[model samples]
Target: MICRSCNQEHNNNFCPNCGEKRDVEKITLTSMMSYAFASVTNMDKGFLLNLKMLLLKPQRITSEYLNGKRKGILNPISFLILSVTLYLVVLELFKIPKKPSDISKLPSGTLETLGNMSYKAGQFIRTYLKFFWILAIIPLGLAQKLIFRKYNFTEHLAISSFIIGQATLVGIISYLILRWPLIFDPVIYIMITWMVYRVFRTNNKLDSLLLAFVVLFLFILQLILITFLIGLSQV
Candidate 1:
């Protein structure tokens, strides 16, 4: 038979030029089921493998990805999207306590109260979760340029996305844990720092520690800003 892919003439099962396998007969229901199961098995195996690599050898994985060895590893953006989506869904399922001073509970006495509540809600979402990528991306890109000596913003962006993705995963876990047993905000911050350091190959432990502190401080400041805006809106 003539193999169209390689334009090769072959009398046997595969093309001699490009090794294209011969087309099989129409798939039966049983064959389809088998194929589906096989696909599922392969997907599960790949997911687990990638997950383990991401957690255990995060630095290596990031380096490999930057070096263009990215076939088996999960794409960083896809990983980020999946992780963030899952985290948000899980967080919705398990509610976190808002501070008593939260503007959402402010009495609706005036237009200010309404505006403040709206602003607070928007700020809370943007500062805490929605704008995380935007805030982290630029700093992370700069960090890469400084630490790894990589000037390519795209590469830095990839690393930044991965770090944030991992951080979001940790944040979700921390949120879940804080729901019942503990409020380990410090630990969560540490984990996020560690994830960023790993991704960026930041060798200086002190610098990483400082960066972590800055990140926590910024988060707290964002909270304060949101609260202040809420109060102002009420006035």
Candidate 2:
């Protein structure tokens, strides 16, 4: 059979040339739902296991993946895609009430103008949530790479992907599923710090914890600055 991906002929279940599936079935509602179900619940493909591992051992999962021990585990970016996809789906299904934008709480004058800009920036980010996630990934990865010099930028990127992906899931679940308010949202920061500390704890526990907080702070500050600039550009 000819491989549709690379136009190479193959006779295997997966394309020997490009690895496209041999049995590319026609798309249908039944097929779509079936594929989604299997992909989400299927243990063989490492979906559920990846989810469990992300919750229980987030650092080990990424560390092992970077250390070339990847086998049954899902790729970090793929996990991020899955997490983002699910977050969007859940968001659409459940319209959690948006907190009313309080312009009066602004500091007046220039800061107030900046506040409005930030609000617009936030609106833009919310509309392009999936795309903005990529923005967050780079900064977080840079922060991680800076503090943990042993791991290179790309390795930290893998770590950031895993960290943000898991944070997205946990954050959405806490807000939408568990009915937690936005004020309690600092849990996500704590979660990120925990993942970073755990990944670097082999050197020195106290130092690792301090550096993890630093990483988290730097990531947040960078994210805010970039996002604010994005907001500023709209004006």
Tens digits of per-residue lDDT for model 1, 1-235: 8886877888878877888887866879999998756643464333444456667887787788889888666677766776677676886788666645555555667765666766665555445564554355556555555545554878877876776667667777777766531113555556656776655446687776666556545544554555566446644
What candidate 2 gets wrong by more than 4 Å, as runs, is: 1-36, 98-108, 177-184
TM-score of each: 0.60, 0.78
**lDDT of model number 2:** 0.79
Candidate 1 local accuracy as lDDT?
0.63
Decoy 2 TM-score against native: 0.78
- Please give the distance, in angstroms, between residue 103's alpha carbon in candidate 2 and its true position after superposition: 5.6
Each prediction's whole-model lDDT (CA): 0.63, 0.79
